[model samples]
Target chain A: MIEHYLSLSVLLFCLGVLGVISRRNVFVVFMSIELMLNAANLGFVAVARLHQSMDGHVLALMVMAVAAAEAALALAVVILLHKHKGNLDTNIFSLLKG
Target chain B: MFDVMVILPLAATGAGAILIMLVAAFETFRREGISILGMGLFAFAFFIQLTVDNSGDIYPFAEVFNGMLVANTFTKVAGLIILACGFFSALAAQTYFTQNKGFVLEFYCMLLFAAFGMLLLTMVAELITLFIALEIMSLAVYTLVGYDRHSVVRAEAVLKYLMLGAFAGAFYVMGAVLVYAGTGSTSFAAIGAVVADSGYLSNPALVGGSFLILFAFLFKAAAFPFHAWVIDVYDGAPLPVTAFMATAVKTSIFAVLANFLLINPEVHQGWVTFLFYLSILTMFAGNLIAIGQQNLKRMLAASGIVHTGYLLIALVALGSERFSGGAILFYLAAYGVATLGLFVALSYLSGQDERRVSFDDFRGLAKVRPYSAACIAIFLLSMAGIPPTAGFMGKFYIIAGAFQAGHAVLAVLGIVSSILSLWYYLRLIIVMYFREPEQRFEVAELTLAPLGTIVLAVCVFAISFYPVVL
Candidate 1:
């Protein structure tokens, strides 16, 4: 059962990586990052069950809180981006390219 | 009681940050007053950190805090360097806002907050605590980067940093989870015990988890392959913020990384081969990028990558019996002073809206602002590892440590990269001295950055005399 959950978590993490790489939309990339964090949370919870300890559960909660903080910051950045360029595409924000 | 003393500096910085935030909200103080406050807070923190007698690894409130924070000579020096970087950056920002527009009241608050996070980062002994500290620093820096919403360039820079930073954060979290799964503990000491009980390579989960965690660290440190965003971000960030990020942030990250690696000799051995190759690639790649840059900021950003490569060499040499962490700490301090000095000098000389950012912009600077030009030259020479400067002594210690650790090839390659770095560092000096002045390097009246630059210039030479055993 733990292996099954771990496999699901890995699958979700892989999907998130794929989304970050393939998607061009800024929002999608951020969502993909959130998905990655969730995958880690899933892994933590499953691993906690396997180890029969509460450490992983606590780690998951901590990760969730960090994820929320990142989300709040990401949303503000998205709004900042929207205000500047009037678009949500990552490719559009290339003024800083070397 | 000793533990409380060890933790006092961290507490002071955090409290100072909150105080600044509250003060900023009231809108009572103007920019100059707040800048002075920020600098004062950093100086206070630096003194507090210096007073702490961290002779050995002292895990503060170990039983009560579950050994989440540790202080030692290494962390103490690193914290001192971080606070000093903050102080100089605040000084630079004071001069910067006098010339340029977009002075926010909350700027000092974010600076304090970032320093607070970096202080926490250096002390973190647990993966979860490390992650939180990393975010706290990252979020504050992100705010500092994008504070000027009116500038489209800043917006673009912030977006790139944000997206990539969040992605890296996710990698770190997943990595922590995997490490937790493998070792069943998040504490460094516990993980070291597990690696000691069972060989590091034999455990597949530990290997993979460490790799992912290292990925996050390397990304933050702007090592090779993960260094693409730094040039752009540093180029776009305000000068003082760039200085802070370049010095304080790197100091903390390397401190934590050294701590993480020192958890066990086996772990360090496991990563040594990887770090060796990465350091080589990072140096040459940075040289290649820096050689083509017309703008001074972009060039400095690239050189930062090269400096990272040098620090990575120090990392590769770490964990040997004879070679202590003094070399790494010394190099960080030397590099921090020189780099921060350059940025502080640039803050004033950049003129209105940063019109003088390119190498060509500084033609004959020695003729007009000879003191400033000389200070910048000192910084550049120090960075290039010229003899009698801190950077030279730092390079000497690191390379000697590398050779002493039986990694002579890395040491030689580091020397070669240092030589290559001169191609760019000297170009600025030549431009500043040889050519005729195009425009007067008029700086704003009563600015402190010039004074900061001179102090750092003296430090570049002074720090060399502080010997580090290899």
Candidate 2:
């Protein structure tokens, strides 16, 4: 039973990673990161159930709070990028080539 | 009371950040006032950190905080470096704002906040606390990176940093969850106990989780594979912000990485082979990138990656029976001083709107401003690991530690990397001294940055004499 939930969590994480890599839209990429974070939250909840402790549950909450903070910052960055370049695509903002 | 004493510096920095935020709202305090306030707060925190008695590892308020934070000589020294970096970066920012266009009142507040996060990052002993501290530092740094929202370059830098940073944060959370699943606890002590009782490789979840955690750390430290973001990001950031990120952020990340790896001898053992190769790749990659760069800031950013590689060598040699992190701390201090010195000098010398950023722009700087050029030469030579400087001693200690740990190959490679690094370091010196003057290299005012540069140049020599017990 635990393995099934763990498998689901890993699948969601992989999907999030795929979204981040394949998607070019900044908003879509950020949503993909949020997806990855929520996947981790799912893993934490499942692992807490397996361990029969509240530690995982509390950590999951903390991860959610941090994710929220990151999302807020990400949105602000998106708006900043949009204001500067007048678009939301990642490819357009290639001023500094890495 | 003892716990409060142990955490006094942390409290000071956090309170200082809030104080700055509130003070920024007032009408009387302008840019100069807030700059002084920021510098004062960092100095205050540095003194507090210096006064804290750190004889051994003390878990402050262990019962109440559940062993989430640990304080020892290692964290103490790292905290001191972070605060000092903040102090000098604030100095650089003051001068940087004088000629540069985008001067925000909240700049110092963000610096204080970032320092506070770094202080917390160094001391965290649990995964969740570490994650929160990491985010706090990252978020503040993101704001500092793009606070001047008008610039397209700043926007691009912040976008790259935030996206990658959030991705790494997710990896860290997942790793923490897996580790908690395997060990049934989040504390380092508990995890180490479990690893000790049952061999590290016997637990699949623990191995996988630790690998992921290491991945996130390497990304933050700007090691080989994840180093692509650093040059662009550092180039786009404001001079002082770049200085802060290069020195302070790297210091805190390495501190936490060392702490995490030292959870158990077995854990360190499992990762040693991997870190060895990664360190080697990071050095050469950094050198190659740095050799090809014409922009001074980009070159410094690549050299920062090479320094990270050297610290990784120290990390690989860590966890020996007599390990005390003396080498790592000493090397960080040396690197921080030189890097901060260069950036501070650049802050004033880059001129209005940072027009004089390329190597060609600085042709024959020594002819015009001999003192500034000499100071920059000292910093560059120190970074290149020349004799009679802190960088030399720092490289000596790390390589010596590697040799003592029986990793003679790593030691030799470190020497070779330093040799390769000199190629770029010397290019700057040649540009400064050997060429004919093209421009006056004038400054509007004498300012605090040049004074800070001299202090740091003196410190580059002064810090070498401080003994490392390794």
Instruction: Compute DockQ for each candidate against the true complex.
Output: 0.86, 0.86
Residue range B356-392, candidate 2, lDDT tens digits: 9999999999999999999999999999999999999
For model 2, how does the per-residue alpha-carbon lDDT over A1-98 read when each residue is reduced to its tens digit? 88888889889998999999999999999999999899899999999999898888888899889888888999998888877778898888779995
- Give Cα distance to truth, residue B382, candidate 2, Å: 0.7
The 10-residue segment of model 1 chain B with minimum total lDDT is B199-208
True-structure lDDT of candidate 2: 0.93
Per-residue lDDT over A1-98 for candidate 1, one digit per residue giving the tens place of the 0 to 100 score: 98789889989998999999999999999999999999999999999998898778888998889889889988998998888788998887777778
Clashing pairs in 2: none
lDDT of 1 by residue, B1-470 (tens): 88889989989999998998888877578888899999999999999999989988899969897898998998999999999999999999999999898889889889999998999999999988898899999999999998998988888888889989988888888888788888989899999999888877777878878888989999999999899999999998999999999999999999999998888898788889999999999999999999999998899999999999999999999988788788999999999999999999999999999889999999999999999999999999999999999999999999999998999999999999999999999999999999999999888999898899999999999999998877
CA lDDT of each prediction against the hidden true structure: 0.92, 0.93
**lDDT for position B271 in model 1:** 88
